[model samples]
Target: MTKHRIYTTSFASVYPHYIAKAEKKGRTKAEVDQIIRWLTGYNQMELEAQLKKQTDFETFFAQAPQPNPSRASIKGVICGVRVEEIKEPTMREIRYLDKLIDELAKGRAMEKILRE
Candidate 1:
């Protein structure tokens, strides 16, 4: 089976778009970074390293230091698809991120966004 193109897409190429989406909605890059950190357990430094390396989405998720167990709680639609209902693991993780960013762009409180 052919792998999805996103699996090989460089994260760095998409990171700016994520930042832009949030910023256009009055959110900050720090908040986006925080969301990424919370989801993938990459500290600020490690996250920066991954961005610098321009890692692919598949590798980025696969090498995550500690993917948040709470991520299963991220239930919502992203790109018209339900994140919680996704059957593929990596795709689910990616959508979890998309949903979180959408919430952020919608101005959800950080505490609740983090599910803290």
Candidate 2:
């Protein structure tokens, strides 16, 4: 399957329409995406049709099944992180790492963290 890259600017442009569709169908954006992927295989028009037909969250999220940990682990590794490390990694951990990387790029605070 092809990975869909949702850019901030593009998402912002269509944000209202997506929100309106979600609200009209009483589904979350994630639910809408899942339903679309299942019903239409990424065809925008078919996705719209599925969204229009959906009347509730349960129907939209019918694809929800707890993923097998091994499958999830394999997918996570494909994106460049170990399964255990990512399982509970917080927004703070991510942001802090980003910040640290930025600081290192500008030549600050590298020795302290590297020596730990």
Candidate 3:
């Protein structure tokens, strides 16, 4: 049998706090990596390459939401109401994101998401 290399332990130990922080905010690994790279002053391309080559579940974490005092307008009524565009949720078309996450967590192949 061939020997398998374990590359995640060092990263795991150092990144646990980041991962926990990210998960608490309900963000995906990719999104969290982006935010962290931005905050740490790393180039985006470098971060992307490293993320795919050397990363674990805990490496990605969501950034906490900023405490903005300004309010954005929300259209339509609060209860049993029809809105013009449905605003927030419809904006990103993220319905597929959940399915993707589930598949990844189940150890499904990630070649598809990488293509996009």
Off by over 4 Å in 2: 1-42, 63-116
| Per-model CA lDDT versus the true structure | 0.95, 0.35, 0.36
- Please report the candidate that would top lDDT against the real structure: 1
- Checking candidate 2 for backbone clashes, the offending pairs are none
Model 2 per-residue lDDT tens digits across residues 1-116: 43223211232334345445555645455543443343224355544554465423333223223322222222222125543455433322222223333333344443432322
Deviating ranges (above 4 Å) for candidate 1: none
TM-score of each: 0.98, 0.22, 0.26
Candidate 1 RMSD to the real structure:
0.6
Candidate 2 local distance difference test against the native: 0.35
Error of 1 at 5 (Å): 0.4
lDDT per residue for candidate 3 within 29-76, as digits (tens), equals: 665454344333445665555455555322332211321111122123
Worst 10 residues of 1 by lDDT: 70-79
Clashes of each: 0, 0, 2
Lowest lDDT 10-residue stretch of candidate 2: 67-76
lDDT rank order: 1, 3, 2
